[model samples]
Target: MSHMPTNIPDQSQIWNGPAGRAWVEAQSVLDDMFSGIAEYLTAQTRALGARQVLDVGCGAGATTMQIANVTERCVGVDVSEPLITLAQQRAVLADSPARFILDDAQVHDFENGAYDLIVSRFGVMFFNDPVAAFENLRRATRPGGALRLVVWRSATENAFLTTAERAVEHMLPDLSRRKDGAVGPFAFAEPGAISRMLERACWSRVRFEPVDFTASFVLEALELYMTRLGAVGLVYAELEPRLQAALVECLRQAYAPYTIDGRIRFTAACWVICADAEA
Candidate 1:
């Protein structure tokens, strides 16, 4: 049996439940959405000449397969069973050397000093005890190994993520109870906080680089995509049919200013962080 992450039970519950299923259903779309970051991380892995690679929170195995293409050994680990299953299925279909494990990375017993490169794209956040989780990850990495992570910079800066919520906020229940800077998508938005956490975890040479890009989606698919996942999606579904229709129209009108040539485009603000295991 895999080692369960006691410190991240809530996170595990979220990922292994509806969130996990939703990701599995939209694997292709999500993969395409994050392709650019995946490509960049893969290139960094190749450039570093990493022989053994571990992809943290490797959802759907997209980045793991990409790294496997260039590295000798690659393993992808996640807490989401559905996502891991989909990733394994994808690996088999593609004949890729990547392997997927359904386990909590925060506590999983990864081979000590086994990986020379650890990477995550829009992962590595959501750890209830981030310092402890990163320390565990550091123990799995070889001395002098590289760690690369791509995370959202800030919710305020990423219009693509918040526009829909803003559009339909009036109809939804008050979400002020939601926690921030603790465990969630934007947990590590502040560079200083994340840097301190990594340093305390025994990682060295930390650096952060801003990566701003535009995300484009087909106008016709925008509603379905936005109404299918995330916090907004969850509450949006509970709304009555009449309100739901109104919300969809509200979203459409709110996004109208961002549409260009039949495609809805918005900015995605993120940070690509790099660090090294203490040698």
Candidate 2:
């Protein structure tokens, strides 16, 4: 039996559909772009020395496998079946001890007090009711168990993200602002608001530290980025061929400032949030 909530329909649809599939297809490029921050988050999780670990929103199972190397037990949970399928295949190929489950962490019925640590990388931002979601996670962790997750600080703080958005906005003009800002990548951008949500969810010793790292990605040109990396591909999909070409040009120019040594390198700002389950 599984406990999956019905409140997060939007997220379920997006993560299980084309958006999720895109991530699966470009896992290598995306991983390269986020490699530095991902390493930092996984290292922090390993430092916790938790025997039982739960990786929430463990996309493609990279962090899950990394932590599994050091932990006695580890499980990765995600909403996207396609991504989970890839994760499982990789785990099998590597003979990794980590288990990957296809389920939404927000409502999945994890055994009470089962995990000694919970971690995420660029996850935990899409919950419709974030407080409720964290409460669910709280119930799954043992008392005093630690949580260490990394999330983008803001869309404006991320040049790689905003460059593409701005490029498309130059072409489509009307696509500048998202109708629901609280649903996408920047959902947890507001530190104060997220802090309040965690406090209301009964987490203790909550701390947020801002970390900025320069991420470098191998790319022959910015067109590769526009077509292969991030949600910009979705935006490109919505365009006519001519307009897509135009957006590509716009992105190339926008990305020029970040290009060095024939690679795209930009500073990404993120928050490393740490909290403890209430005893």
Candidate 3:
């Protein structure tokens, strides 16, 4: 359950986007989210080993720096210029050889197997054309290399976000109608859409596993996080302030049931798909 890579009508419109300012306003929550994400990538890298790793959406380079610590080469790609700028700054502090690229879009240019391992945290779901996008990612991997990623599962399984959304639907206009933002949660929300896409892109032995990770939401802090970044943030910006406050209140109550021992307990399920190139 995340926002899409926005392709605004013009460059001048970039800063005006709802999610554009989310990075700064929601830094604390994002920091917490990235902490858990870094742990996930660290485990994945230990399994994949220290090699070439490409982070598809390296927001602020938290996980990217972690991968760079172990891998020989790391490149972070993001659509947000502001975020990329921050990532570069952080890279300087970490002293990691990670390069960041800012592009309005991602395309089908695997560049004929240029990477060894490709990774994304909660990225990859919002691409313009996922089949073409995965095909390009397949092209980027060296033969026998791997692709690893995590994405939101269906609403039935992720009540943490779904319940929040349902509670606030009337407060804000339906963001689902935005035509541009990828549909909520898993864009490939269907059962086998992931493996099918990979197979079509020349990947083999694709596998999907359930990802059950807990997320915490400190109501005051998380409210800032939810309405400030990416698509969800943008939707919050579109609403009237009074409605937005009411909406956040609704979420507070909705999410209260999940809080355990002072920490929120929300679990996400994803198909941790892995595949090797044809050897």
By TM-score, the best candidate is 1
lDDT of 2 by residue, 19-134 (tens): 78878987777678777766776677667778898988998988888888887988999999889999999999999998998998888999999998989987787776677788
Q: How many backbone clashes does every candidate have?
A: 0, 0, 0
Give the Å error, residue 66, model 2. Answer: 0.8
Looking at model 2, residue 165 earns an lDDT score of 69
Candidate 3 lDDT by residue in tens digits, 1-279 = 222245424421443244545765565576675467678876787787848888886767777888887878788887777778888988887777888877632553436777888888776765655666777777778888888877667766766555655666666455543221244346645647667877877889988777787666565575665566444566676678897788777877876787677666666666566778776
Stretches of candidate 1 exceeding 4 Å from the true structure: 1-9, 176-180
The TM-score values for the models, in the order shown, are: 0.92, 0.91, 0.83
Task: Work out candidate 2's RMSD over C-alphas.
Answer: 3.2
Best by lDDT: 1
The runs of at least 3 residues in candidate 2 whose Cα sits more than 4 Å from the true structure, single-residue gaps closed, are 1-9, 176-181, 221-224, 228-231
TM-score of structure candidate 3: 0.83
Against the reference, the lDDT scores of all candidates come to: 0.82, 0.80, 0.67
Please tell me which model should have the higher TM-score, number 2 or number 3. Answer: 2
